[model samples]
Target chain A: MSSYHLDHLQHLESEAIHVMREVAGEFERPALLFSGGKDSICLLRLAEKAFRPAEIPMPFLNIETGHEFPELIDFRDRRAKQLGAKLIIRTVDDAIARGFATPKPGIVSRNQLQTPVLLGAIEEFKFDCCIGGARRDEEKARAKERFFSFRDSFGQWDPKNQRPEIWNLYNARLNQGENMRVFPLSNWTEMDVWEYIKKEQLEVPTIYFSHERDCFRRGGQWLPVPPAHTGATTPDPYAGARPTEKEPVKRLVVRVRTIADMISTGMIESKVHSFDDIITEISAARVTERGSRADDKASEAAMEDRKKAGYF
Target chain B: MSATISHSRPPVSHPVDILRFNTCGSVDDGKSTLIGRLLYDSKSLMEDQIEALERSADITGGGQINLANLTDGLRAEREQGITIDVAYRYFATPRRKFIIADTPGHVQYTRNMVTGASAANLSIVLIDARLGVIEQSRRHTCIASLLRIPHLVVAVNKMDLVDWSEERFIEICDQFNEFLPRLDIKDVKFIPMSALNGDNLVDPSVHTPWYVGPTLLGHLETVHIGSDYNLNGFRFPVQWVNRPNNPTDRQLHDFRGFSGQIAGGIVRVGQKVMALPGGQTSTVKEIWTLDGPLPEAFCPQSVTLVLEHDIDISRGNMIIGLDQLPGTGMDLHAQVCWMHQRPLQRGKKYFLKHTSNTVQAMVTEIDHRINMATLVPEPAPAELVLNDIGEIRIRTAKPLVYDGYATNRLTGSFILIEQGTNATVAAGMLLPSEQLVRPESGDYVI
Candidate 1:
């Protein structure tokens, strides 16, 4: 009888797989939101386990910020092509150029700029549902999110009035224009993701491993310095990214804990190169992964405010 | 009896199991505070989270940090100083991983409590030691029982307010036990503690010299939840059909499998199973999980099952063992917790979602609504409004395979989605289908 027990990782994995299969079965047009991050990398694996021996039913969608690491974009393309998945990359640069999004003054992050591009892609593809790698453990606002979160036609989340998800049954019904953002990994924490990646031997971007890189200190976080631009015709995207003269450029051996925009994501200085070392470091870590993310530090309710405004 | 032990190396740690439980109590009973203290004392709170709490504490001025802000993420919730919705919190000790469903305890939010407890193996009901047992306590306990939560912990919080008196704690325990026998829950524990002062949460408090049981965290870590799911009856609700039909890959060209999470019991390769409604029997050819092919699989593990013979089965169909068959019928009697602003009445139609299947269903009759205060049934209420739990009769467009709610939570539970709005209006738990009294004439007879 003891053999019947599934470990915590297995339990979380089973739940996530169940959710992915539900999306495949219920939705007429669904898309997987893959960002080339560890969480989304895990999402791809879950999708494989869910409908393998067959193609993943949904296409993959990505909202690419122009400031993203070149390595991440390359990895994203490679993973999609390897799986024979249809990768749809919508860009914030395109949205800004088309006047769909207006940039805020002094804000070079482009974090908020991705929301419009995502909504526009949904409209372009007429997707009824978008499965994301977002987990409740990621943010406080997410803690109250539903498994099958309903969004209005504008992709806005109404935090106060979420559907009561009872048992394992989810209500995925939608009117025209309204779509749902389904999160299969809602119960998983940062530790669960790392453990799963280890168990499945899933490949992640090389930036997660410890390496020496040119970096700068700003707002008490280590941000990687974007590679110096050659004489390309366009302006440097990394310019004014540091925001203040007090932030000094320095070379540091650091590794990114989370894969977001290169400008917004922060790295911790450690010698953690292997998965075991990473897991041990996380076990003794004192700060949440998002603590280093400057975007979340914009305000106490930054994530919640952004979530209500249709940001994933 | 000579044995040499290797003292140079540490033993490799086994994987940690998960425990899902919920906390429910009245607004001021310290539900969120208990959760905050548990996470903090368990060393689960990260540095950034503590900083965020401190920042929010300044805005919501009390000069003292309010631990509730740790969970009340929404601006409205922070301003109002109340938990309006269910928030899930995750923490882990080396021994186990825990998922805490922090639900609001306001009377109007009974629907939220029901939603939180729907999937929990255990429920913690917080009682204010100064106030003793109140109507809200009874209401929460009744709900935990109605939801069939296997374990209950009555944490008498704010013990410092009552000077940590053993007599006061015992008196509160006595009050809870007076109504405990009326409920269906089997395991119940009462503890005295203060969520504010971090007493009896992670570590046993020295103040409680009279109480000699495990601390709240100790009990949570060691509670028996391995047998929570029904293992005697094999039930699988097919969610999707896996097929490749790939031209390039030879082995996948003619593949077809039923995919779903096992709802009950265990299934093995070459086992005989029956599909509901059609009643066609088939032999299981293979059971494949993400890891690989498995000789056997049990409840709650998702797998793709290949049948030996081609059969007519699709989503919404249940694959089950030949014995301990579930009841099959169109008439379903259930207790539902109404959720929408619109009241639930007879003649209203809804999309009844049970397991993986959704079928058109109409309310045939409203039998009775349970009075939360007295734990008695009020016969034939006019209508079940929001947050009201009542017994109702339903007629589905097609037959549903189900067991009683007491028998299986996964198989017996359902949700009612409003047709036009597509809003989930009710959470329902099916009563024993065998108790459905059918009329011989079938002419709307009661």
Candidate 2:
């Protein structure tokens, strides 16, 4: 008799695949929220396992903050094309130009601005459900989220009034105009994601590995320094506010631990190069994965506030 | 093992075992505090997390640091000094990884507790040492049993408040054991500890010299949950049909497979299987995992199964072994825990979602409500209010393949959704179909 058992990584993969299939079966207009991050990359692999022999039942949706890493954007588009899935991109720059969102004065980071663009895209595409790669272990607010999170007609999430999800039965019923944000990787931790990437041999943005780049220090984190002022018509908003003389720009060898907007995503000074190195580093690290994300460090309730405002 | 790594560091090479459990008790029984102690002592708390806890100490009042703040993430929950929702926390020791579902312990939040316990392999029922075995303790224990949780740990908290008396701990243990036999739970372990003072949580405390049992964390790390899954009858509720149909790749041109997570038992290639409701028989040709094809698959592992001959199978269809077949019927007798604000009344139609199948169902009769305090069945309750547990008879529009809750949780459990609001109103555990009320009986006339 063969003893069949799934290790932790395989178990998480199974659970995630099951959730993706559930989304495919229940929703008429479901889309995968592909951010080109490690978690989202894992989602793509799970999607392949879920609906193989057939195309992923839904399209790929991405909300682009114009300030995103060039590598991430390139990888996102190439992967989507390789899979032959429909890719829909919505930009924060367009949301600002259309008067749907207004940039806060002197605030160059478009992390908060992406929420409106995402909501607009959802409304325009009439996506009944959007599958995201958000994991509960990422933040405190995320820890309270349900597997099948229900959103009101306005896309607002009421954390206190979430539907009770019992066993494997997910309540995916939504009224017209209402939507659901499905998270298939809710139970996965950061280590699990990296281990899975290694097991599946999935490709990620090259920036995740060690590289040399010009960087600057701000708020105790290393951030890539923007190139010399390119005098364009738009006039980059971030250039308007330069780093103080106390925080000098210098060329350094560093790598990004997470891929987000280029302005807010922090680079860590490390010699770690491969996925194995990353797993070892993460196991010995003291800070949470989101500690490097300046967007979430704005306040204690930063994620909760964004979630309430319909941010994925 | 590497010599360069320090002995104090967590062992990373061990095969990681995942344990999911929930903590439930009365509001002030220190459920959250016990979880915080476990995480803190296990060295799972990061430097930033400890700093955050220290920073919020002033806001939460009391010169002392409030450990409960770790699990209570929501602003409202922190301000109200209570856990209002189920917040999941992950931590790991050298031995195992754990997912802690810190559920609200208030009486009105029974639905939240039920949600937390639904997927737990074990349940920790906290009891205040000063106030041994109260009504809330009994209520939570009954719920743990109803959910069919395989393991139970009765943590007698606040042992310091009771002067660390061995007699007091024994008294509480005796009280719990008196009622535990009535429930179906087989394994029960009791421990005396103080979540606030950190006694006997991760390390054995000198104050409890009279106690000779594993520490709370020790037991959690070594508890035998290997046999929790049902490995007797093969049942696979198809979640999707994998048909790639890619023309360029010759191998993918004609691939068709039934995809789902195995809910029970072990399935091997060449095994004879039957599709439920259709009664179509076929032999399993191959089992496919994400990595590659496998010769055999077992319960809880999601895999795609290829059959020798394709019969009519789709989502909501169950593939099972012919030997221990599940009951097929339209009438179901079940025990339901009402979760909605509106009372559950007879004659109301609902969307009964069992496995992947959803069917229109109606509450034909309300048998009786179980009084949590007395553990007695009250005859003929007119309606089941929010958080009430009662026996009910339901009739579905189509036949459902199922087993008794005692036999198989995945195949036996279901949720009732209100047709209009689509809100999940109740969670139900099916009784055996033989006990189902016959249509010819006088009860069906209503």
* TM of each candidate vs. truth: 0.96, 0.96
List the candidate 1 regions with Cα displacement exceeding 4 Å: A242-246, B1-15, B435-446
Candidate maximizing lDDT:
1
User: Could you tell me the fnat of model 1?
Assistant: 0.86
- Candidate 1 per-residue C-alpha lDDT over A192-213 given as tens digits, one digit per residue, 9 for 90 to 100: 8999899899889988889898
TM-score values for chain B across all models: 0.93, 0.94
lDDT of each: 0.88, 0.86
Q: Would you give me the overall lDDT of model 2?
A: 0.86
Query: Which docking class does model 1 fall in?
Result: medium
Give candidate 2 regions above 4 Å deviation.
B1-11, B248-251, B435-446
> What is the DockQ score, from 0 to 1, of model 1?
0.64
C-alpha DockQ of every model? 0.64, 0.66
Q: What does the lDDT read for residue A138 in candidate 1? A: 89
